[model samples]
Target: MNTDYTAQEIQDLVSEVLETADENGVLPIVQLGHPVLRQRATAYNGQLPTQMLEELLEAMRQTMYDAPGVGLAAPQVGIPLQIAVLEDLYPIPESSALEREREPLEYFEIFNPSFVATSDRQAEFFEGCLSFDGFQGVVTRPADITASFEDREGKEQSRSFSGWQARIVQHETDHLFGTVYVDKVETRSLINESELWHHDDLDVATARRVLNF
Candidate 1:
């Protein structure tokens, strides 16, 4: 896939993908081995018309929700653009949510997103990607961050996020730069999703010991 595209090229590409979407309007998510996943995504710069961009974002949002994931980036859908959508309603048990310092987040779209850690503190948790289904691994990330991005209206915005929200932002932003969780994960801690239940309740330290990572 080409790493860079002109405005018309992007519009054409997005149009084609959207037109061929499944009945649910979910675009096909490219998998781990796809070259697009490894290439740094091109920055967004009015390459798509307003309405077309909105349509593309809506489809990506549906795709993310259908995947049941907190976030999705353009590269995951083969667009290779610096755009992503994120939301986390904290669907897990209250106990688990509290354990992970998770809080509910409403859905939102971001373009040309970037972030910086706000604290030295870090947290480790099992992170999964829509691109790499049915597997997860322990990845440590900054526990807090301040992200800068353009909202759906192209307005520049900056905000701070902590705990699980911070992790989600970092994960999606990394996708724009061609980085995946597995690249930063404790490899020995990798496991099939079917086996994830065994470690769900364990703290990072305990999980690390049990997984020998």
Candidate 2:
């Protein structure tokens, strides 16, 4: 298989993949080895070819919900464009008290999103990705962040996010830059999601060793 893919080629291939998905009903997610996932996504210019961009965004939203993931990036679906969808509005069981503080976010669509840290506070958590299914890794990210981007309607939007929402935005935004959360994780910190446990009371140091890796 050809591993070398130019940026344009990646985008074109994504379009093809999406076209094929129309018959299958869901966008086929590109996996870890795809060259498209490694290339920096192109900025979305103000152009919507036959409402294709809108349809793509909606499809991405559906794909995200189907994957049961909080966020999805264009690159994950093979479209190397600056687009992503995320929402954390699902009900959390009271037993998962650690996530109680994470504010529920309505579905958000960001195009050409850019992230900035708003505070010095930092937090680390075990995060999973749709691209790297079934695995989780510890990633330290800013606890508070503000991201600026254009909404689906092309209006500029900027919002601050903290807790899990901040991590979601940071993770998705990093995908646009061709970076994955695993890139920031210690090799020893990687674990299968099934083997992970809640470590709300444990310190970060202890949490790393708590997992039966």
Candidate 3:
């Protein structure tokens, strides 16, 4: 059956699916048109049950892994809490010329995160989000950042990140502030994921050459 849903209907349907996610499994990821994806998420006040928070974070991690994305935010899953999970555990290959300096990032979670630019230097890269499926956009962000956030147990954790790791954290943190990569991308730089991937050219130079970004 073919059905055309209005934006509000789609948003409501996404919320319903998230609300009914398996108790110990992946949650539905809300897409671009949902209002929840556009709202600034509320800060975590350490009031929710610790057990519940644990399960949610675990489910978020599982969802992120299933989507095979570098990060996932609570808002993307239809939760307005200030929480996100990210990991870039594998190294960039030597063939990725622009990212050879990047290092592997261990799994981490952040709540109510905030960041400060450690350098005035800026860098541009293509980024994709679970919420903005099937498209990638070019965004320029500070080359280095230091961020602070609460851990799962309500303990404070502060860290500095650079290279791809810095990009991952900044992208996820922006979600908490109601900002998506589309909002900051160069208009001419958006490319469908299929055209950008599924080819031998995976470096910045090749991307700019072919996509004209």
TM-score for each of the candidates: 0.95, 0.85, 0.86
Give the alpha carbon lDDT tens digit for every residue of 126-155 in model 3: 788899899987888888999999998789
Candidate 2 wrong stretches, greater than 4 Å: 1-15, 22-24, 95-100, 197-206
TM-score: model 2 vs. ground truth? 0.85
Per-residue lDDT of candidate 1, residues 1-213 (tens digit) = 577678888788888888878998999999999998898988898888888988899999999989889999998998888999999984688887887889998898889999999899999888999999999888999999999999877799999999999999999999999999999998998889888776557667787788888
Give the Å error, residue 49, model 3: 0.5
Q: Candidate 2 lDDT, tens digit per residue, 115-167?
A: 89999998876788999888877788999999999987778999999888899
lDDT of 3 at 213: 69
State how far residue 28 of model 3 sits from its true place (Å).
1.1
| TM-score head-to-head 1 vs 3, winner | 1
Off by over 4 Å in 1: 198-200
Candidate maximizing TM-score: 1
Error of 1 at 81 (Å): 0.8
Model with the higher lDDT, candidate 1 or 2: 1
